[model samples]
Each structure stands twice: as C-alpha cells, then as structure tokens.
Target: MRMMHNFFRIGGVAADLPHGWIDKCLDFCDYFFTGVVEYQKLITRNPIFLEWVEGIGIVSGKEVLSFLFCDFIL
Candidate 1:
C-alpha cells in the first residue's frame, strides 16, 4: 500500500479514507487491452483460441459465442 500511495492520488469520491479503503481504490484497475506481450500470452494459452482466426473465415462472431465459457487460466 505504501508503494501505491505515492504513485496515485485519491480524490473526489475517494477522499480521506482508511486502510480498508484499499479495496475500493482497486476499482480503478479493471482494465482491458493489456499490451502485446500480455495479449499474445492470452490467446496462445486459451485452448479454444482459434489461431486460424483471420478474415472471419472458420467461424463467424456469432458462431464463436456459444463456446465462450472461461478466460485465460494459468
């Protein structure tokens, strides 16, 4: 917590707070589009990740929706 306190400043909805408020601060961390390295690691490790996915060939976006169950799990 000490390391993160200096890295970011809390304001507005987050004003004077307590140690327990650390969980609330974490709400800002919900992020998408992680980076190239992380992206590659994501798709490559996903068993259902269709490597041949290109030009919308093998499956349309709708067809793939049925298989959606889990995310990348290590």
Candidate 2:
C-alpha cells in the first residue's frame, strides 16, 4: 500500500515515531521549500505561461455584482 493505516489514534499516534523518522522529516521539510521554489521558478515565472494568462478573464466589480444578482430558476 502507498500509505499506512491504523497509525493515528483519537488522541495521538499509535506509537512513538520510529528511529531516524524525525531526521528524515526534518530533511523533507528542508527539501520541500526548495521544491516549491523550483516549481515557482519553472511554472509561475515562465514567460509562456504568463503570456497565456495575461489580460484574460478580467472582471470588474460591476460585472461581478450583475452576475451575482442576476435572477434565474434554481
């Protein structure tokens, strides 16, 4: 299985963390931010992705209210 079950209890975990678990977890925490930065650099800062989203689907407050108040059968 991809994950473990019966590892959580109502109040706490089923048992103490395994040896080296904390170190591994700390390493993952360190790596996670780097992964997020890499993702942002590759995706969010990409020129092609920005070009696709630029000036698209822009809505004004008036337009939003018009849609929100428009009457229709539910």
Candidate 3:
C-alpha cells in the first residue's frame, strides 16, 4: 500500500496487472475489504455483460495451454 501511495504522489497509476480477470485481481484484495461482495454487485444476474466481456478477451486454446503454468496469487 505504501508503494501505491508513493506512485500516487508522483501522478502514476497505483496499480496494474496482466489479466482480464479484474474482479479476481490482487490489487482489489490489497485495498478493498469485502472485494467479493463488490464484485458480485457488478455482475449479479448479468449474463449479457459477461458474454460481451468474454467475446472481447477470449483466450485461444493454444494460448491457454501456454499460460497454464503461470501463477496468480491473491
């Protein structure tokens, strides 16, 4: 969190990540309490929204295999 404060002081982005999974990203856990509740609020019963997002960022089968070993920690 101190790193984020420092970046904010310099007018840079306080956070970034390498995934399409924003709701499950580490930065939210780093800052927000009840992150799961917040995530559910945005997508509750919203299948159309989810489908649109998946269409835009869908991973290819080969790419998924290549990235299967990448680690994501929360």
State TM-scores per candidate.
0.21, 0.40, 0.31
Candidate with more favorable, higher TM-score: 1 or 3: 3
Candidate 3 per-residue C-alpha lDDT over 1-74 given as tens digits, one digit per residue, 9 for 90 to 100: 54644666455566665567776666677767667777787787578877767658678776776687553421
Off by over 4 Å in 2: 1-6, 46-74
Residue range with the least summed lDDT across 10 consecutive positions in model 3: 1-10
Residue pairs of candidate 3 with colliding backbone atoms: none
Worst 10 residues of 2 by lDDT: 65-74
Model 2 per-residue lDDT tens digits across residues 4-45: 788777998878878999999999999897789788897878
| Residue 21 CA displacement from its true place in model 3, Å | 26
Candidate 1 on 23-66: residue-level lDDT in tens? 76565444433366688886877665755553455675655665
Candidate number with the higher lDDT (1 or 3): 3
TM-score of 3: 0.31
Measured with C-alpha atoms, the lDDT of residue 11 in candidate 2 is: 93
* TM-score-best of 1 and 2: 2
